[model samples]
Target: MEKFYPEFSARFAQFLEHIRGRRIAIVGHARPDGDCIGSQVALARVLGTLGHEVLCVNPDLVPRRLQFLVPGMRFARTDEMLADRTDYTAIFVDCADHARAGERLKGRFPVVTGNIDHHLSSAGFAEWNFVDVHSAATAEVLAGMFFDNGLTVDAQTAQGLYTGILTDTGQFRFTSTTRRTFLLAAELMARGAKPTEAGFELYERETTGKLQLLERFLASLRMECGGRVCVGTLPNGIFEATGSTAEDTEGLVDYARCIDGVDVGVLIEERPDGAMKASLRAKNPAFRLDRVAAQFGGGGHACAAGLNYKGGAAGFREKLVAAIAAQIAAVDTPEEKK
Candidate 1:
């Protein structure tokens, strides 16, 4: 891939030249995370600085905490922009597939270009793809592109890049974070990225309702596989009692992962339609939650993944636990053989 960097860079440059005066739509996944939000915002800033018209389209409203990061971001909620079939270019960032853009925008535009991502699961969903799963964050990829292209990284650009790198890497604590991650982070900081301030705003700041939701999830924690796996559930009743919104449940899977003697953690949230959304976390390097999630029609990174089950809460919980247990058994069998 190193040998092809120059070629890829040249191709990307050509694509940027084509987009010079076009109306471009930058999109992220449905439920955007820091990496998704940051990549789109950073790309939008770069394009806007280049005198191109760009709109950042997010399926949902930007999280309250992230609103301050991308002040110029535009929210495109309806399918009209996508269906009009007008002369507009589409750029998807940090999404694994075009489907990740949501059904509303998929296959609606002709000239799809730009592919800034850090997920191995990305299906090369653009005319120009720049995917490096080894990178800790998509923002890292975008930052490098910006630097390579001679674009200036102002304070806001630095902030957006910092948030993307920080959250996706779990503040640089995840295994995927390497020397390159810190190197890029340091460079961004030198260009005015303040990690201390961004860290506090992104993680330290939480609402009371979110705290109550965390307590409820913690109370429902369960263990399995000789304490190698921990599971937790959040029922709608708990959400009602705590006045917690769905957004409040974001990062609750980390709680199960933090428990001592647990190699894998699972969080199941009961949806209003009786189905369940499962979030999986694996601390053990040998465990690949992405494979586990794919079995249920979902995919993500190795350590973290998610799946949606279409059954009653009881049945969904039962099947999910059994599936996770099977994966655990498969991993342990090799050790037993050894």
Candidate 2:
């Protein structure tokens, strides 16, 4: 076997030794996506087999699409785990920053044991921060680490890790998907990861309400920056109107980005409480959407990023457009012209 993560695997061995006898809480970000939930489950199961007591914790409930990975497992939310008082050593996974787990969770676990992630903007916030920006997903980082360190990955863990890679790679169609990703997926299948089942759960389970929501999103699409950018807005209360939830916004932005000549796609969700949430996806990694999201205190990979802000959507939209537009102009203009 080729050592998938040779360097990180050695560090992982030290991490395993560091927390040998401690109870662990695998904390994930709020409004958990496939990668977040998948990484949490995969890590929890692996650690559980090592005679370590482990629990999965998240700020929000596992979304519908990712529920398959959590069978027979109970996830502790903010209140449940905070009241347990188990003295859990926090191991944050797939979170770019402390705030990604929500302010309340961050306050509870100010000090962290380990942080494993693949986001380009990941902040090294833990004692053993294993971040590989080149990996397509945090689960990929963990899978590599586990395989390299000779850790056991049962059937369920394989599915969890496989789902993380599948979703984060845009179903293996995104530019981030690499040879290692496919090779890992193949190995995972040999270990009992079912691609057909995962595909059905993640994609084929879309409801009529979700289609309605997508209709609204498509209708709201507006081309900007001379058609190079496609922006869609979901108005406040639109979820109620469409009979859909935030999770339904999952792949809506991709429709915008897949269009011809559109370099970037955006989905801006307006909240009733005056907070704004935006999802940014770029066809080209050169767009560095993560940097654009960082300007607003959000972060992720270069091609995909997101942000949450406390303000009117319109005001935020203007600022976001200007930033993205500037990025576009920088690429368009010749260096000598400047």
lDDT of 1 by residue, 39-83 (tens): 888888888888888888767777877776877577675465655
**For candidate 2, which ten residues in a row score worst on lDDT?**
329-338
TM-score leader:
2
Off by over 4 Å in 1: 1-8, 79-86, 335-338
Which ranges of candidate 2 are over 4 A from the true structure? 336-338
lDDT of 2 by residue, 120-185 (tens): 988898989999999999999999898888889999999999999999999998887899999899
RMSD of each: 2.7, 1.6
Model 2: lDDT equals 0.91
Which candidate number has the best lDDT? 2
Clash counts per candidate, in order, are: 0, 0
Q: What is the lDDT of candidate 1?
A: 0.80
Structure candidate 2, residue pairs in collision: none
